[model samples]
Target: MKSYTIEEINAILKGELIGHTTEKIVGPEELEKAQANHITFIGSSTYAKLWAKSKASAAIVNETLSVEPGDDRALIKVKNADLAMAKILELYNPPKPHFDIDIHPTAVIHASASIGKGCIVGANCYVGKDVVLEKEVVLYPNVCVFDETIIGEATVVWSGTVIRERCIIGSNCIFHTNVSIGADGFGYRPSDDGRGLTKIPQIGNVVIGHYVEIGANSCVDRAKFSATIIGDGCKIDNLVQIAHNSVMGRSCIMAGHSGLAGSVTLGDGVIIGGSASIKDHTTIHSGATVGAGSGVMNNVAAGQTVLGYPAQEAREMLKQWVAMRRLAKK
Candidate 1:
């Protein structure tokens, strides 16, 4: 574990410091468990009492705290305690991998694939024909990118992930383990004899925007016509399924096990909770929030929070829950 002196930390945080400036701060900990060598945080006034009893040698507090004369541990006062904690964590962050050799010898690249400078293609990775991998892109072992796929700069695709043909991946995007991008959408029509289903050919691809992160095993299916789009800064949790022709606006978040059916349109900053299911052709306006396990069948207004099955407004849903509990007393 790395250590920083009280004075050294004060210099880094650039905040007002109180108490002894020589105690060696090793790592961060919660207020209750923090030792003399650990740094703790007080984000609210409610935690002030807890801080007084905490064993931490150093603490980060927000602007609301005042200097206490009796308790004299090293305190760093800042505008936001949370942001300060993030900076402190960066100081102890693990080292990144060094890619001295750009492409591993075991990797297979087709004749027409174009790999940019400083890119790292790991062992057993497959790059298909006419694929374009931009500078500093990293593909971990067993990753596959099909023909004509264009991966932007500094994108990282982890092991066992697949990006199918003609998909466009933007810069600084992360596709975690076993993610499936541009797979065929679930589309079928009844056969001529009405005995079986006929598959609809998914001719379109997926287009991902910059700084997006898709969690492990999540899948974004290809479009039946144009692209199935994931907008910039969107964060998708594990086991999320985005079906054909679904278009999400920037910074939208979909929690674990969430499903968006084909042709769903989500506006900017829409937040879908865990296990929520949106029906086909539904539109969720900007800044709307869908509660966990919700079933959305109709269009949602801007900035609304919908909850429960056959989703209704959150406040109304809570009232219904209260009424149900009252009736259950009988």
Candidate 2:
């Protein structure tokens, strides 16, 4: 366990000390799990009460909470205890090194491809013809970058991620394991014989903007002509399906298991809860929050919060529900 004195921790975190600054802390643990010489945190008064009985050497506490120091424990007050904990973790956590930059002997790089400096291409990875990978890109084992794909600087693609032909990923993006970008959209047309399905060729690619995070096992499908675009800072959770021609605005959060059909547009700062579905050609404006399990059919305006199947305004849904119950009682 890494140890730091209370005074040392205060200086490192720039936190205010409420008790003895000479105490030594060995590591961090949850309040319930903390042992002697460990520092813990209480984000709320309920946890503060629990912390009073803890055997921890020190506790990070919110400023508004009243803490009576026990003989064995001291309090370090901060504006936000959780944020302080995050900062401390960031400071003390060891850095993860990028894999050494070398193409494995088993990997295939086309002669026409361009790989920039400090890029690591792992075993069985494929860099297709005309592909361009910028500086500091790391591809874990068995990644496949298809033809003409463009990956920008400082991108880290975990193992088994497949970038289909012509996909364009911007700088500082992270693709977790098993992510598939620029795959064919779920588009099909009825056959002339009316007996079979005709696959529509997805000729376009997906454009992923800077600082985007695509979670593991998620898929972003390619468009027919235009691109499916995920804007800068958008965070897409695992198992998400972004269909053809969909446009997600900056900083939108699309939670796990959510799906957007073709041509859907989400404005900046939209928050989509888990398992939500946005139908084709729908639009959701800025700051709107779509609750979990929602099926959004129509458009949602800025700052609106909607819920339920064929999602309606949250407050209106509650009011209607209450009225229905009252009538049922009658």
Best by lDDT: 1
Query: Candidate 2, 78: how far from true, in Å?
Result: 2.9
Task: Please report, in order, the local distance difference test score of every candidate based on alpha carbons.
Answer: 0.93, 0.90
Q: The CA-based lDDT of model 1 is what?
A: 0.93
Give one digit per residue, the lDDT tens place, for model 2 in 1-330: 567887788787777787673556777888888888788888997898887668787888898999876674678889999899997777567766545548888899999999999888998999999999999888888999999999999999998999999999999999999999998988899999999999998888899999999999999999988899999999999999999999999999999999999999999999999999999999999999999999999999999999988799999988987999999999
Error of 2 at 144 (Å): 0.7
**CA lDDT of 4 in candidate 2?**
86
Runs of candidate 1 with Cα error greater than 4 angstroms are 10-12, 16-21, 44-49, 65-72, 98-100
What tens-digit string does per-residue lDDT give for candidate 1 at 1-330?
799987888788898887774568888989999888888888988887787788888888897887452344788888999999998988878776665577889999999999999899998999999999999999988999999999999999999999999999999999999999999999999999999999999999999999999999999999998999999999999999999999999999999999999999999999999999999999999999999999999999999999999999999999999999999998
Model 2, TM vs. native: 0.90
Colliding residue pairs in candidate 1: none
